[model samples]
Target: MSDLLERLRGRGWRMTAQRRVVAEVLDGDHVHLTADEVHARAVTRLPEISRATVYNTLGEMVTLGEVIEVATDGRAKRYDPNAHRPHQHLVCGRCGAIRDVHPAGDPLADLPDTERFGFTISNVEVTYRGICPNCATTA
Candidate 1:
């Protein structure tokens, strides 16, 4: 994510140490973490980092296209750093685990032309919800 940091720096983003730490926290971990979760982890590394700072940094990153937000439900939104790739998400219905997935077909094709009411369609996000293996085994 050094490249991302450099790009953000070139874009005139204030490279505060807190922001760098926040970026490192997201970059080092592959899992999708909610803002609260991210703040919790960041606190361990930099106790002075406030929740607002983390939230602001995350919002800026999202706006800059350096991150993506994934919502498994109506609850907290998780941040995904794998923004460079095009993929979908498979969410566990019972345990809330999320796995990145790649479907075989173009998802946009599934939206039949008849469904288009003359509006320009841009993108699609498909989330498949099911019981994960570990959760299934427990049940």
Candidate 2:
């Protein structure tokens, strides 16, 4: 079972055929697929599945905190299923590929009291941008 599917089932999320297809399409490491891309893949598994269904399922998953919506490069919002883990993004500037990167310490602790402007910091999002190996080799 995919991590996203397992988490959804554990949370008592209703498992419809369309939702299941979407979850399966999103199952994998470094998965950051846009709604259209997800819909395209879901159509391969279940021919009757609609684009709206994929969009709605993704929205619900994002709302439920089971999936994370990433808008890298401002092209389209990509859905990430690795929400249960704490990690950052490494994006390829040339090809726009994204990968999950786990750096050493706690980012929350890195912010000192003096640097914080008084609001409580609940989370942090870090994105490292550079050319990926494939793009670098091609260039």
Candidate 3:
């Protein structure tokens, strides 16, 4: 997205071919790609792009709030590009597949009043883990 690039440029980021390729690889709906996976896809378009470049670009995007880093099972972090809206993750325990899900109630409401500990809570992350339909059917 040109708008993303312009925002990046405004943040003093030097636009490079590799960075552009990385951004292109991540632009899509429900895209949850690891750094290595992103590098592999970016290489298809820009053969010269390196893994480090992809990692760096991904980090930059996350820092800019254009991407969100999700850690499932403490394995490789996945990069999610759906940062425009708020949602939580529904993760498949068997295949590690992730999908965005909006739960029924406000997450902040679930926190116990005693647990606030005098700190203002600005956000919350709720991750629901279970066997996905494909995994459950095969079992």
Candidate 4:
């Protein structure tokens, strides 16, 4: 996307072939890829791209809020490209598949005043883990 490239350029980020390939791989709906996965996909377009370059590009994207890093487990962090909107995550516990889901209500509304502990809270992230429909059917 030209908009994404413009934003990155505005932020003083150089657009290299590796970085461009990484960004292209990350662009699409429901894109959740790890650094290695990104590198694998990027190499398809730019065979000279290295794994380290992919990781660096992903880190830059995360820092710029162009992507979201999701830790589904204690293992490698997964990168999500749906950074334009605010939403929660639904993870399949069995297969490690991730999906973006809108909950029924504001989750923060459930937090009581007593839990504030005199500190101002500006944000909250909710992660719901369960077996997805396909996993459930297979089980």
Q: What is the C-alpha RMSD of each candidate to the true structure, in Å?
A: 1.6, 1.5, 1.9, 1.8
**Residue-wise C-alpha lDDT for candidate 3, range 65-120, written one tens digit per residue:** 98899987798999988887898999999999999988889979888999899999
lDDT of 3 at 37: 97
Residue-by-residue lDDT tens digits, candidate 4, 20-95:
7777788876788888998888888999888778888889899999888988787889898888888788889999
Over 4 Å off, model 3: 1-12
- Top-down lDDT ranking: 2, 1, 3, 4
Please provide, for model 1 over 1-139, each residue's C-alpha lDDT reduced to its tens digit, 9 standing for 90 to 100: 4666776788899888888887877873357999999899889989999999999999999999988988888899999888888889999999999888988999888888899988799889999999999999999
* TM-score of each predicted structure versus truth: 0.91, 0.90, 0.88, 0.88
Candidate 3 lDDT for residue 124: 84
State the lDDT of candidate 2 residue by residue for 26-138, as single tens digits.
Answer: 99878999999999999999999998899999999999898899988888899998888888999999889899999988888988899999988888988999999999999
Poorest lDDT segment (10 consecutive residues) of candidate 4: 1-10
Pick the TM-score winner. Answer: 1
Candidate with top lDDT is 2
Q: For candidate 3, report its TM-score.
A: 0.88
lDDT-best of 3 and 4: 3
